[model samples]
Target: MKKLLAFLTLGLLLFLAACSSEGGSAKEPGNNGDTSDSAENAEKQEVTFWHSMGGAGQEALNKIVEEYNTSQDGIQVNAEYQGTYDESLTKFNAVAGSDSAPSVIQTFEIGTMSMINSGQITPIQEFVDADSYDMSGLEENITNYYSLDGKFYSMPFNSSTPVMYYNKDAFKAAGLDPETPPATYEEVEEASKKIVESNPEMKGFALQAYGWLWEQLLANQGALLLNNDNGRTDTPTEIGWTEEEGKSILEWVKRMVDDETFANYGTNGDNMMAGFLAGDVSMFLQSSASSRDVIDNAPFEVGIAYLPHPEDKERQGVVIGGASLWMIDGKSEEEQKAAWEFMKYLQTPEIQAEWHVGTGYFAINPGAYEEQVVKDAHAEKPQLQVTVDQLQDTKASYATQGALMDMLPEGRKIMETALEKIYNGGDVDEAYNTAVEQFNVAIEQANAARGE
Candidate 1:
C-alpha cells in the first residue's frame, strides 16, 4: 500500500512537470508564440498623405513615395491624390477631426490662414522642436512664406513663383532680343506690340484671369494684397495696395485690350496654356512649376523670365505659389512621427532635385541645386535656371512674404472677376472700385467670423 501511494505521487509530479514545460516552451525567448506581441513589433506604421499633385507632379511624387516605402521597414506611406487645391481643401474640411482625415495634407500657400484656424492640424513647429531639425538649409523665400513670427507652421514642399514664359522664336521674329525678355510691365507691353506686328496671326500676350496671377503681379511691384504688413503683423481690414499701384496693372491690361494684343482666356489657365502651346500667344505669365510642361511640349524655343514689375516700382519679387505639407491633428504620436520622417525625406537634396527637375517646382532645399541631376537638367534646359535665379534674386519684403487671410481664396475670385471685366473692355475705374469694395467686405466678414 505504501509503494502504490508513492507511485501515484510520482505520476502526479511528472504530469505537473510536463504541463509546466509545455507552457514554458510556448513563450520561450525568440519564439513567436505570442502573435499579438510579434505583430505589434512587425507591423509598419501607416501614413496617409493627401496631395493635389496631378500629371507630372503626381508621377514624380508617386515615385518618391514608392522609394520611401521600400527604403524603410518601420513605416509605409500611402499618397492619395485629392484633386485641385481648392477641391482637396473642401474634402479635407469634410473629413477633418475624424478618422477619415489624412495623416498629412498638402494645402496651398493662401490656405495657410485657413489651415491655422481650422484647429485640425498639429503645427509642424512641434515636430521641429522635438527633433531639433534644422530648417536653415531650405530656400529662405520658401521658408519665409510658411513661417510666421519666426515659427514654421507647415513644411514647405512644392514651392514656385510666377514667371513670364515667352517664345524665344517669337521674340526674335519681333526684332526683340530673345536673350533679354521683358523686365517691366512697360517692356512687356512693348514686346507684345512687336510680337503682334511681327505675326498678325499671333497675339502678343495672354494674361489668364487668374486671381493668383493678380496677387503676384501686385507683389512684383512691391504692393501688398492686404494691409497690416500683408496680415503678417495683424489682421487686415482693407486693400493694401495704393490706388495707383493697383490701377497701373489695370491700365496696362486696358492698353493691351485696346491694342488687340491681349488674348482673353477668361479665368481659363488651361486654355491659355493651350494657346501658348498652339503658338497663338507669344508671351504669358504663369507659375514656374509649369516650366517643365511648357518647355517639354512647346516646339518653339521657350524662355522664362522674372515676373514683370511696374516700370516705376523696383521689382520686389514673387510670393511662393505652391503648397505645403501639414501634419494633421488627432493622429497617434507614432503616426505623426512617421509622417514627419517622410516629410524630412522629401526635403533631402536628392529627392528635391528629382522633384525640381520633374515638375519645374523650385527645390525648397537649395542644396538640391548641387545634385548632378539638377546640374544635368539645367545644362539641358537653361530656362530652368532662370526660374531658380528669379527666386534667389527676390528681395525679401512683406509683399513677397505673401498675405495671410482665410478670405484670400474668396478675394482671388473677386480679383478674377475684375480682371475678366477689364479683359472684356469694362471701365477700369468701375472694375477697380467694385473689386476694392468687395475685397474690403470680404476682409471685414472674415474678421467678424473669426471674432478678431
Candidate 2:
C-alpha cells in the first residue's frame, strides 16, 4: 500500500502535463516520404531517447538512430545525450512528475531495481508479447540480468564482462608463456611474484578498488553478492561482502598488498591502465568494453583471458556491465509502439554487428557474429573473440544473473567504503559488520521513502 501511494504521488506530478491541451493533441512532424514539412496530413509519432553515452559509443548510437530514422517514415526518435548514467537517471526521476520524460531511456544495470520500483516503465515484455517477437538470437546470459519475475524488464545493449589483461612482453620477460595466462588465483599470484622478483622496479598487479570488480569476483565463484537471491525474492536488507567468497577476495587482496605483489590504485580503472601501459604493472583486470582503447593506446603487446578464478572453482561466469534500453510508462500507445519498433530495428544482426565492431561492447544478438563486419573484425583481432566466448559459455546462475536489490547502488558504495577500510589497516570483521548494519539502515530509509 505504501509503495502504491508513492507511485500515485509520482504519477500526480506528470498528470497535469499529460492532460494539457497541447499534450493531448500535439503531433510530431511526419517523415511521410515527403521532403517537405508541409505534409500535414501524414501522421507522425515522436520518441525521445535519453542516454549517457558519449564519444565513440555516442557516435555509434547516433548512427543507429540515423539509420532507423531513414528506414521508416512513421516514427522519428530524437536521441538526447544526457550526462553520466547517474545524471541521466536523476534527470529522468526529476521529470517524472512532469510529462517531460523521454519515451525511452538507457539505464545502467545498477539502476534496474530502482527503475522498476519507480513504476514509470513499460516492460519490454509487454510489447514483445504483443507482437510475438523472436528473441532466440539474443544471448541468454546477457538478457538474464535485466529480467525480473521471470521476464525481461528492458532490452540489453552494450553488454560487457571483466577480463584479465596482461602485457605479453612482461610475461615473456618473466620467463612465463605469453599464450598461457593465469587461469587461477594461485597462478596469478605465482606469475605476479615472478614478475616482481625479476624486476623489482615493476609491480606484479594493481587492481582498482572498484565495486564492479569485487562483484565480479564473487560472481566468478558463483557467490551471491547479496542474500535472497540477490534480492530478487525480497528487498536486500544488508551487504554480502562478509560472506565466504567476499572474505577470501579481501584476504587475497590484503595479502598481495602486504607482499608488495599488488597495490590498490585508488578507485580508477584509468589509473590502473596507465600503470600497466607505463610498465609499472604487468597485469590488470578491466572491462572487455575497454579493449579497443587499451589495444590501440598501449605501447606493448596485450593479451586477454578470462578473469582468474579460485583454484577450487572453475570459471563459472561473469556479470554484464553496461546499459539497457527501457521504455517509459505513461506515453501514448503509438509512441510506445514506435519505441518498440526502434528497439527491434537495433537488434537486427547487421546493426548489432556494426555496434560491436564500432564500440568494444559485445553484440547481445548471438547471430551478429555471422555478419561480415563482425567476422572481418574477428579476423583482424582474435582477442575480440575471447570476450564473446566468455559470455557465450558462461553458465546461468543466481550469482551470474547479477544483483537485483533496490539499494544496489547504495550497497556498492558501502562495499567500496569497506574495501578502503580493509586496505587501511581496519579489521575485516569489524568493517564487515559495520557495513551490514549501515547498509540495512540505508535500505530501510530508502524503503520508507518509497513507501515499500
Candidate 3:
C-alpha cells in the first residue's frame, strides 16, 4: 500500500508538469496575460508599399525607408519592388479583390482615375485634415492632377516633365551644332534631316511607344484627349484622335517614319533610352526621371532641353509624368493615423530634397526648390537642376487631367494599333478613325461591366 501511494503521487505530479508545458507552448511570442490587450498595445503595425522604382532609384527609396524605420518605433514600413510602372498597376489590379492587398501603393499619375474608381484607396485629404498638415505651399497646378472632384486622393511623390535628351557626340558626327539642341518642332525636323543625312549609320531620333509620344504631342498642341475638363469629372464621352491636333500629330509621325528620321525603339522608354545610350540614335525625348540613368550610364556627352513645340509661343507647356503614393482602405483609425504619419514624413523638405537628388525625381514640395541643401546639391550636378527648371512654369496637359476612362489602357492599345497600321503603309486617317470606333466600344463595354 505504501508503494502504490508513492506511484500515484508521482503520476499526479507528472500530469501537472504536462499541463504547464502545454500552457506555455500556447502563449504567443511577446504575449502577456490578455491576448486582446496585448494585440492592441504590443503589436507592430506594418505598412506595405508596392512601387516600380528599381535599380539605383529603388536603392535610394530603400535608404529612405531605412531612415524612417530607425527613427520610429510604433510603425514599420515594408517596401516591395513591383517591377516597372505598367507591371505595378497590373499587379495591383489583380490583387484588388483579395484581402491581401498592400496598405500603400505607388501608382502612375495616368492610372490615378482607375484607382479612385476602384474604391480601395483612402483619400489623403482625411490624413491631411486630421493632422492639419499645411498644403498651401504645394504648387496648385501640379497638385491639381491628383485631386478629384475637388478632393485630393494621392500625394504626388516623384513628379516629372518631358525633356529633350540629345547625344552631343552624335550631333557632332552628324555635322549639327552639338551646343544647340532643337528648340522647335520645325527645328527638330530640320536637325533630324541633317543628322540622318550626315550619319547614315545611325537613326536620327527615337520616340518611345505610341502612348508616351502621342500624349506629349497632344499636350504641346493644346488639344484635349477628352471633352469637359479632360475627363476630370467623369463624363462618358471620349474625344477621338481624329480631331485637328490629333490628326496633325499622326501626320507628323507618319512624315518622320517616311523620312526615316525616327527609329522604332520598342514600346517602352527604357528601350529608347538604350538606343540613345548606344550611340545608335541621335536624339531621344524622354522624362526627367531618365536623367539619372542617362548620366550614370551613358558614355557620351548628353544635352538636356525642354520639349519642343511648334513655332507658336503659346504651346510651350507639357504634361507631368511619374508616380504618386496612395493610402489604402480597410484599415482601422489607428492604422490610418500611422499611415498618414508615414506619408507626411515622406513629404518633409529634407526628405524630398534627399530623394530628388538621390533618384532624379522632381521634388513635389514647393519649398524643396528653395532649400539651401537642395540648391547646393544641384550646384554640384547641373543636370539635376534641369528637372526643377522644367517644372517651374509647367501646366497640366489635356490627358494630365487624370482621365477617368475605365478603358484607358484599351484606348491606348487601339491608338497604338492605329499607329502601327499607319507605319506599315496603311491609311493614317482611316486607321485612326477605326481605332477611335473600337476604343469607344471598349470604353462603353468597360463602363457597363462596372455597372456605372
Candidate 4:
C-alpha cells in the first residue's frame, strides 16, 4: 500500500511539471503567443497624397516620397499623380467627404479661395498651432501667399515668379549691354527695336497671351487686381487698379505691336519657349521655373532679369506662383498626423534644397539656400541665384501677396481673351473696357453663388 501511494505522488508531480513546461513554451519567441500588442505597434499608418506634379516635377517628388517611406517604420506615404491642378481639383471635389478622398491634395495658388470655401480641407493652422511650429524660418514671400488673416491654410511647396529671359548674344549683336537687360516697359520697348534691327530674322520680344503674366505685370507696378486690399480684408466688388494703371499694360503691349517687334505666341507657352530656343525670338517673359530648361537648351548665353515694371512706377514684385499642400478633412487622425509629418519633412533644408535644385521652384524654407547642394547648383548655374535675389528683393504689399477670389481662374480666361484681342491688333480701349466689364460681372456672379 505504501509503494502504490508513492507511485501516485510521483505521477502527480510529473503531470504538474509537464503543464509548467507547456506554458513556458507558449511564451517563447517561436511558439504561438499573445502578440496583439506588438502586431498593433508594427502596423504602419498609411497616408494618401494626391498631387499635380508631372514630368520632371513628378520624378523629383517621387524620389522624395520614397525617401520618406524608407526613412521610417511607423508610417508610409503613397503619392498619386492626379493630372494638372484643374483636373486634380475636379477629382478631389468628386471624392470629397468620401472614403476615397486623399489625406492631402495639392492645389495651385489661384485655387486658394476656392479651397477655403470648399470646407473639405482642414486648414494647416490647426497643426501649426497645436505643435507651436515656428513659420518664421520659411521664406517670407512664400508664406505671405499662403497666409490669410495671419494664419496659414496650406503649406507652401513649389513656388515661382515671372522673369525676363534674354539672349546675351542677341543683346550684344543689337549693341545693347548684354549684362544689363531691360528693366522697364519703356526700356523693353527700346531694346526690342534694337534687337529687331540687329537681326531681321529674330523678333525682339514675345509675350504669350497668358493671364498670369498679365497679373504679374500689374503687380510689378504695385497695382492690385481686386479691391478691398486684394480681397484680403473684405470681398472685392470691382477691379482694383485705376483706369490709367490698367491701360498702361495695354498701351505698352500696343506700342510693341505697332513696332512689329512683338512675337505674339497667343497663350501657348510651349511655342513661346520653342521660339526662344530656336532663336526666332530674342527675349521673353516666363516663369523662373523654366530657368534650368532654358539655360540648358539655349545655344547662346542666357541672361535672366527681374520682371519689368513701368518706368514711372516702382517695382513691387511678382506674386508667388505654384501650388500648396492642403490637408483634407475627414481623414483619420493617424493619417492626418502622418501627412503633416511628411509636409514638415519636405520643408527641411536638405529636402528643400534637393527640391529647389531638381525643380526650378523656390525653396519655401530659406535655410535651403545654405545647403551645399544648392550652393553648388548656384555656383554652376549663376542664373539660378537671380531668382532667389528677385524673391528677396520683392516688397511686401497687397499686390505682391496676390489676389484671392474663387473667380480668379475665370478672370484669367477673361484677361487672356482681352490680351489676345490686343495681340491681334484690336483696339486697346475696347478690349480693356470689355475685360473690366466682364471681370465685374464674374465677381458679382461668384459672390451670388456663394450666397454672400
Q: Model 4 TM-score? A: 0.91
Give the local distance difference test score of model 1. Answer: 0.93
TM-score, per-candidate, Cα-based: 0.91, 0.88, 0.85, 0.91
Evaluated at residue 24, the lDDT of candidate 3 is 75
For candidate 4, write residues 1-452 as lDDT tens digits: 99999999999999999999897766757534657645543587988899999888999999999898878888888899999999999999999999999999999999999999999999999999988999989999999988999989999998999999999999999999998989999999999999999899999998888889989999999999999999999999988988988899889999999999999999999999999999999989999988989999999999999999899998888899999999999988888998999999999999999999998999999999999999999999999999989999999999999999999999999999999999999999999999999999999999999988
Off by more than 4 A, model 1 = 1-42
Candidate 1 lDDT by residue in tens digits, 1-452: 99999999999999999999898767646656666535644688999999999988999999999998888789889899999999999999999999999999999999999999999999999989999999998999889898899988899999998899999999998899999999988898899999999899999988989899999999989999999999999889898999999899899999999999999999889999999999999999999999989999999999999988888888888888899999999999999999999999999999999999988999999999999999999999999999999899988999998999999999999999999999999999999999999999999999999897
Question: What lDDT score is found at residue 58 in candidate 2?
Answer: 93
CA lDDT of each prediction against the hidden true structure:
0.93, 0.84, 0.76, 0.93
**Per-prediction backbone clash count:** 0, 2, 0, 0
> Of the pair 2 and 3, which is ahead by lDDT?
2
Considering only N, C-alpha and C atoms within 3 Å, which residue pairs clash in candidate 3? none
lDDT of 3 by residue, 261-348 (tens): 8777657667788888887788878888878778778898888877776665456466667788888888677767777888888888
Candidate 4, residue 33: CA error in Å? 20
True-structure RMSD, every candidate: 8.9, 10.8, 5.4, 9.9
Model 1 pairs whose backbones collide: none
Question: What's the lDDT for candidate 2?
Answer: 0.84
Clash number for candidate 1: 0
